[model samples]
Target: MRIVRAGHLPPLLRLPDGHTKIPGVPVGPLLGIDATARFPEPELRLAPGSVLALYTDRSIERRDSDIRSDVERLQGSPALLGGGGPDDLADGLLRDVCHASPDRADDIALLLTEYAPPRR
Candidate 1:
């Protein structure tokens, strides 16, 4: 997959064998900010059963804590803890990470894409 960061966070990559990493995608200017800007499209090859996670900052940002720490904490989030399917992960992240408290005022968006080859 080729990813172009338009001022967005690098996607979280989780391998089927339990390896996880946040790719170092180059950050580009926000969309429409510069029409002549060319963003770098970093290519990545994902093995079968690998999962790519895309989420907004609100998913990890908190007023009482450090964002950098929160970013690293994502690896331990409920969604990435086990081998749960995307649906289960979505629910867990929304419950435990994004919606831990309804009093906060931050919109959240998360997407999980899994690459699974047909079984032999």
Candidate 2:
């Protein structure tokens, strides 16, 4: 799949075997600031049962926490790796990460997609 991300935050991809962080290329700049900004399209061949997660910065940002460590924790989260639907996983992530802080300054948004090949 071709995933083109053009912002400051990157996304996460979880496969049946492992998980990884998809890095976004440094595009010209954030949208609206540069109308002519061109982004690089990174592509990947996702295996069946792979789960892709796209989240906003608020999902990981905190007042006094290391984002890298939080990301690592998120990758190994049982809720993310557990057997559940996209909605369930999203809720779990939000509860485990964002909801822990009640003084968050920004809102969180998460989108999860699981890849399932067509059945014969």
Candidate 3:
């Protein structure tokens, strides 16, 4: 998969074996922030059953903690570490994020997906 972010966090990938990782993607400037800036599209391979998690910063960000650590905390939460379908995962994620966050003044956006190509 190729990814180009407009100042968004790097996507998280959960392997089939249940190992989750934040790929080392280059951070790019937000769209229109740099008129002449160029973003790189890095290619990474995804194995079947690997779920790709893309989310907004507000969902996990906090004034008391680093965003990366917050993500790591979420990575170890039941939401992402537990076994379940996409719906279950989504619900769990929301519950965990909202419950842990002190204030809820912004909306949370998340997209969890997996690649399931048709069997040949």
Candidate 4:
């Protein structure tokens, strides 16, 4: 799973007041898997409403038909968000593909999520 350190969190080592008086540079880590090397702690931030899509390599293997059309058909469906979460959309897409296939011969995994900023 992708991991990120949010905000100006201090290091594990600290003083009694739980504050870093030593004015150290605060950093956040961003990580990704696949082709590039995974960053244990990446320094990147995402704005609100940002959508992160993580799909298995099999996502491009749906042959015998137009892949874009297949994806559009699922995205345009009303039941895509039945679970009240973006993750449901991925599940719905996979389910549609699996059901359409003659037999579920391959494994599929998909994750879609929207990043919402924390409310103060």
Candidate 5:
């Protein structure tokens, strides 16, 4: 799998045994500033049971929360680390984090996908 983020935090990847945060490369500047900016593409091989979680900054940002801690908490959550389908995991995460408060100032967007390489 390949991931590309212009100016966003890298997504999280959870394998059957453990989890890891994908690192982002040094890409070009934000759009509108440099029209000729270029970015390098990086690829990764996903295990059959690997689960990838992608989200926007709003999902983890809060008025009184540490971004790193919040991300770590989400990554270590039982619902995410536990065995389950992508939909269930996504729903659980959103329900736990997004709906925990009613004063969110930004929109929360999340996408979860499971990697299952085709049989040869």
Candidate 6:
């Protein structure tokens, strides 16, 4: 999976030119824009059963000793969380994260996409 495209979505925040998609890339914010500037480098690759896990810093923020436990709990319950698709999981995780932390200091965004063989 090449980094077909990745970036912030302009909604609650201000964006230059007010456009999410640039000419060459698809619809989304470029990874290094604004609040997204601190995000680590994006990585993409094609592999069997590849799962792309993305999350905002807020997802792991907690007074609890280990937030990974929270993440693992969610990961263990795919059906309970959402059974639609990559986009659905992404949306669900974002909603869940926000609900878990209503007063999140930073905007929370998470996307989990898996690279699977296309249906024949």
Q: Which candidate is the best by TM-score?
A: 3
After superposition, candidate 3 runs with Cα above 4 Å error: none
lDDT of 3: 0.85
Tens digit of per-residue lDDT, candidate 1, span 1-120: 898889886688888876688887898989899899999998888898888899888877877778677777886775686687788777877887855446668778899988887689
Candidate 4, poorest ten consecutive residues by summed lDDT: 11-20
Q: Each model's TM-score?
A: 0.87, 0.80, 0.90, 0.42, 0.83, 0.45
Tell me the tens digit of each residue's lDDT in model 4 across 1-120: 233333322211112222212223343443333345433453334445444444443543456767555554444434343433456655665666566664656776665666667789
Candidate 3's TM-score reads: 0.90
Model 4 residue 82 distance off true place after TM-score fit, in angstroms: 5.5
Cα misplacement distance, residue 98 of candidate 4 (Å): 1.8
Ranking by TM-score: 3, 1, 5, 2, 6, 4
**CA lDDT, candidate 3, residue 90:** 89
Best by lDDT: 3
Query: What does the lDDT come to for candidate 2?
Result: 0.73
| Alpha-carbon runs more than 4 Å astray in model 1 | 99-102, 118-120
Ranking by lDDT: 3, 1, 5, 2, 6, 4
Q: Give the backbone clash total of model 4.
A: 3
For residues 1-120, what per-residue lDDT tens digits would candidate 6 score against the true structure? 434345532111111222111122243556556564433333344354444555554664555546556555445433323345566656665666666667777665656555577788
lDDT of 2 by residue, 1-120 (tens): 787676656667777765555554343456677787777776777889888888777777776777776667777677787767688888888887755566888778788998999899
Clashing pairs in 1: none
User: Over the stretch 1-120, how does candidate 3's per-residue lDDT look in tens digits?
Assistant: 898888998788888877788887887889898889999899878887888888999999888989889888878877788767678888999999998995979989999988676699
